[model samples]
Target: MQAEPCDQEEPPSVLWGLDPIFSAHARLYVRDILQMKESCQVPGIYFYRFHPIFTVDVLGTVVYRRERDDFFCYGVDDGTGVINCLCWKDEQWKQQNEHVKSAPRSLASSHGGFNPVEQLKKLQQAQRSRSQLEIGDVLRVRGPVQTSVQGQREIMASTYYKVEDPVMAVQISWMLELPQLYRKFYDRCFQMQESDLTDSAQSAPALLGRASGLLKDFLREKAVERFRPYDLLQKLVPLIPDIPPEPSTQQEPTPQSSSKQLHQLLRETLQLLQDEGLVFRKVISQDPVYQVTELDKELHRVTRDIIREDSKREKYAEKGCHVLHVLSAVRQRYCPNVSKVVIEVVLKILECNSEIISTTDSHYIVL
Candidate 1:
């Protein structure tokens, strides 16, 4: 499917907002996974989002009881693709135990000759109080999103609510359906291609039918788009610096400038360590190599001072550089995440300052 426009600023605040909400205004760090939602927001006026990827943990009410007494869940979209209600009635957190799914062992389980209207009133009241929240209100939620054959798209939410309206569950339910609706388009694409790929139209349907039922089942099970991933973006959005705490007179760094800073810091730290005898530079493969030996000597050094300044006290005297040791340790942990191509690109940028390293050599520029 072709990439479509992502509003980036949709309601329920799908857009990841600035960190640290100021005053009383709401701020967000939304995700589509219930597990992430719980980890993110603090207790206050906050929003949560997730999809059906986690149906077992979220709490919601029994919104619609079908003729067979099956329940349908509903809740707020709350971004992060999480719908706090109308989730987990059919599939999410499947009720494997027959006895558990039978009913709660409460008074509602017993069919007394009670008035239907009175029972409804009590149910609504309990929902409002966030007690026995079966069919309305709001909830604190977390988890992933996905669809079920038995239910419309649902969220595996953390919190449930019994609020003032019946329309919300239905409305949020529609919002949660976006991913599945998109998936449907993919299925349509596959279907349209199937018959054309085979010479025998009779065998074509059967051949294409070989696609895994289990895959389909898993996709449905994980059908809700509860998470915000770059994969969902149709095109590359302009890269902006991460939001900083409060505001400052100085402008923030752009991506290009930030990358340049990293290059400069690496070169400077390397030079400092080399001068301090922390790094024994060797020529290997026609490039500088380094070894770290003094890192063990400064285990007790104050980290902040070693990084930028030196201490004057006799007991806390300045020590040899151990930044190379740090560089080595960092290389061990994170070298795999970065591409060699990126390293080469950065080295080329550094090569642009060739007067300091190689006044006569142009061959070193190719890195």
Candidate 2:
């Protein structure tokens, strides 16, 4: 009997570098760090879903410690899991340690009414002591992640320091902020354009672009404001080319395969439309219905009016109206189904037309 060949997974595209998050220091839990899948093509790089993470920021208590001549190794736990961190000793601190040892402490104090040099040395020593953490001290580490010889993931510390969090305020803030990051970024899949695919000429992306164009034209011609997936699937089926039977095996494309291809094309096309701000889903449910954004003039009107009215209020007099406040007002007045992303798209259009100005990243004011 012959053995069956296993299907190989495709390597991640180099175009992943174009994504801003791919280069940023991703704040992740120790457990997720340990669980991340390392890229097969690139060593030391790991992926959490579609997001590529090379460097990370972590906060935890030092549960174990080992001292070395040039570096310190620590086991840090942040209520998730423990990971080893290698922190190198600073050369300046090493020189300071030698100077303090060689110089006599009493010699400075004997003449010290107020010696500047002695005070400076004392301050340096205090800082050095703080940097060298004890086993129980809370530590914040930022560095690129790597795998050790024994195949365990570890961080090669670029920057590590002791965090003094009294009354647990820092920890509480971190706990609150991390979930928002996950919700807004980490959990979302990084979308890849059709041009990024391996076969550009006959790839899924080329098909997706064609399908998206067809759907947009259909929406415009029919004046469609709302649509469901099934409503458009029939129109897209003709785009999927029929496969001929193989010469040797005489294998033809199955009905299931054709249906799957049509569905996949529609799915990608819808996602592309959503990204371009042409359409958005009012609700997330088993049966998703899309609203054509361009057809909704009231959405744009309500969003702009809300910003204009709210910007003059005392609450927003300093920074103008915040994006969140605009979202809330638009949802209440215009349409309850309006999303943050749709609101953001509307804001960008209004800004481009010189109807409004961005006071801050999240605040807007009428022109």
Q: For this target, which candidate reaches the highest TM-score against the unseen true structure?
A: 2
Off by over 4 Å in 1: 1-69, 79-137, 142-154, 163-367
Tens digit of per-residue lDDT, candidate 2, span 26-110: 9999989998888766767887745778999999999999999999999999877899999998888767767767876567667
Worst 10 residues of 2 by lDDT: 3-12
- Per-candidate TM-scores read 0.20, 0.54
How many collisions per candidate? 29, 0
Report, for every candidate in turn, its global Cα lDDT versus the true structure. Answer: 0.33, 0.79
lDDT of 1: 0.33
TM-score for candidate 2, residues paired by index: 0.54
lDDT of 1 by residue, 126-203 (tens): 543552343334444444444446634445434444444466764356345544543443122122133233333213
Tell how far residue 157 is off in model 2, in angstroms: 0.8
